[model samples]
Target: MKTAVEKAADTDYRELSVSPHLITEAKSALMHFERLCGRYQQMYNTQVQANKLFVVKAKNARMYISHFVQVLYMSIQRTEIKEEHLSLYGLEECNMIVPDISTNEQLLEWGRKIIEGENIRISRGAVPIYNPSIAKVKVMYTLFKEGYQTQKLHQKATTRVQDEVAAYREKVDKLILDIWEEVEKDNMDLATDQRLDRNRQYGVIYYYRKGERV
Candidate 1:
């Protein structure tokens, strides 16, 4: 005696009823949410750790630079030596006072110029010297500069990525909350009458009576 429309509606309502499958699906959603949240947390933690590491590296780099500069300052401070003293001096070997100098690339370029007999104005009135070893020092200096700049850029990029990832995680969390609210609203009858837990994460649980399609 039931009309086709009434039968269809009844079927739909039955399908909407709470079920174990819905609970499983909701639990899965919560797990997914937990995973996403954990991912963000891990990324944030990694960035923090990286920053700490950079601080240590930066300090070490500074120390090396200071040591190299000290050596150069000492060499220049030798007032006893005049132009003649250096004129007789051959190219001194360039040593890495610091494993990496911030301006090493620039120094390297300068080194190449030195090799090519590039004009190196020592004192305001001093003539350019074409020393093989001095060219090497310039090259090393250039390398240091390049290395420092590159590392600094990388650090900034890493920080930016971390921030973006964190923001994304927050947005996803909000979406999950909204989804849960919507599911709760649409299935209030089942949630309230069935005494089902509506606060679960993910979509609402749709249950079917025994021998039901859902």
Candidate 2:
């Protein structure tokens, strides 16, 4: 997202450094377009900041769940449950390590199992596994679930903003094209390559194929 806005900014900045005569002919108008793109880039930043908040919160939640599962698995040694049913306590196949690719949904599911299994065990006179009780762990999972939903909403909103940025880019590109076209028209008598070279002085970029040059 930042890249898209920054690219448009770069183009506008370069084009603003145009040939001297264009000061009266086009430079002021060019500044207007530059400011238009700048305004949209600022708008895009608001969405960027909002999306970052959700991303950071989601990461924190994932980290907590991963840690909680790992700690619970290690504490399973103090439990009376047999190895075959260890997954009921959220230990994956009785292993103490959480998978590297575990997602928020998967982590939340593990949290559910940990609380339920722990509660059942507590009912039967089983000692609590770790220092943070299952009740407290349940609280963490509940908060984590809430954050997951918030993260989803933010992601969707950010996607919509990204589409708007795309539209803004197109609008800016058209403005640039109009300016470049007028500049070319003003130099219509010059040879094509010569005229293009003149436009380059106004920061009008031209693309070349691989291994090609001016």
Candidate 3:
């Protein structure tokens, strides 16, 4: 609808006896709409895709953490470390008692503490667990963090674009309506079909009922 209005204002306004100012207004509105739509689409896509990646990364991190805990139990059993040593691996109990790291925020805090505790323990002459070790868990957590931050950024961008689009929507609608009315009034002397054809050349929109002939 706005596209037709823009072209009408540019090339058909003089013929349709419409004001030239409508052309500039339509162009500005159309340009802003185009930019807003493009930006909004980009932000929405980034948010969606980033969130999906974050979910996968988060799941991967959770799986690795579970594996690390299993290995920690076995590894500690073979060592001289006591139950008190469980705290060094970010666990309070030695019997598979893990925190409820479900939400992304919880997972973030859990993973960070686990990595830090493991690092501290390893530095204190503790052997690093093999296979699904803290290093691997850290990698997964880092990926999850990256995806989470990206999704957050684009979510805000999408919201800002939505607000701008909302604020400008009525203005664009009014401009298009004004241009349509002026063009139709100028071409009113012609037959309905002829006037419709003329109006279309000036960017007029027509809506036909469903199942009705065009």
Candidate 4:
């Protein structure tokens, strides 16, 4: 006959119906997802930082040119300069010119287009590898499900194991309580005899025939 403790231990040992192949496939799927998230996040941060730095440098360049133009205009005004007098500033001929792109908005828009182009190139390069990785994850999931059977069956088996464990624990506890109660009763009977002997040793004795004093 199996002891209560042995039965309890057996109840705790549950055989998983899931196959090792399914576990390996599931892990591969998780790893793929992790890599995809990490790679995309890294690329996104790099592109954003690059774009911001490009915009900042362009703005600084524009500011420096604007300051130089303003100083030149003020000096020309103070000297009572005419259009032809611009030759001193390295110009053979003087003519008023209007620029096609002369605003901060236009500069920012051009920077955005460059950033977009770079992102497109990166995405195009990744497409061949990215699409296949996604398909592999899908295939792995299908195989994992086939190996493990249905989700409902897995859940029912798990619940059954849990119930067995609970019942085994209950039986183990009752067995322990019964053993303890028997030991405690024997200890109580021994304790009464011990108390009487201890009293006699301390010189307080009781006798039925006559009074014995110590």
Residue-wise lDDT of candidate 2 within 61-138, one digit each (tens)? 566656666666666565644454455565656456675426667766766777787787778786765546666667
Evaluate residue 51 in candidate 2 and report its C-alpha lDDT on the 0 to 100 scale: 59
**Candidate 3 residue-wise lDDT, 43-141, digit = tens:** 888788778777888899888877777677776677745567788756875366667778888788878888898898889888777798788889988
Q: Can you write out model 1's per-residue Cα lDDT over 118-176, one digit (the tens) per residue?
A: 23334444434322234444544445545556566665766666566576656555544
Best by lDDT: 3
Highest TM-score scorer: 3
lDDT of each: 0.45, 0.60, 0.78, 0.39
lDDT of 4 by residue, 97-211 (tens): 2112255454333323323432443465522112223234334333333333333354455555555555555544454444334334434444656744533332223455667
Span of ten consecutive residues with least summed lDDT in model 3: 8-17
Ordered from best to worst TM-score, the candidate numbers read 3, 2, 1, 4
Residue 128 error, candidate 4, Å: 54
Q: Estimate each model's TM-score.
A: 0.37, 0.53, 0.71, 0.28
Q: Which candidate would rank higher by lDDT, 2 or 4? A: 2
After TM-score superposition, what is the CA distance of residue 74 in candidate 2 from its true location, in Å?
5.3
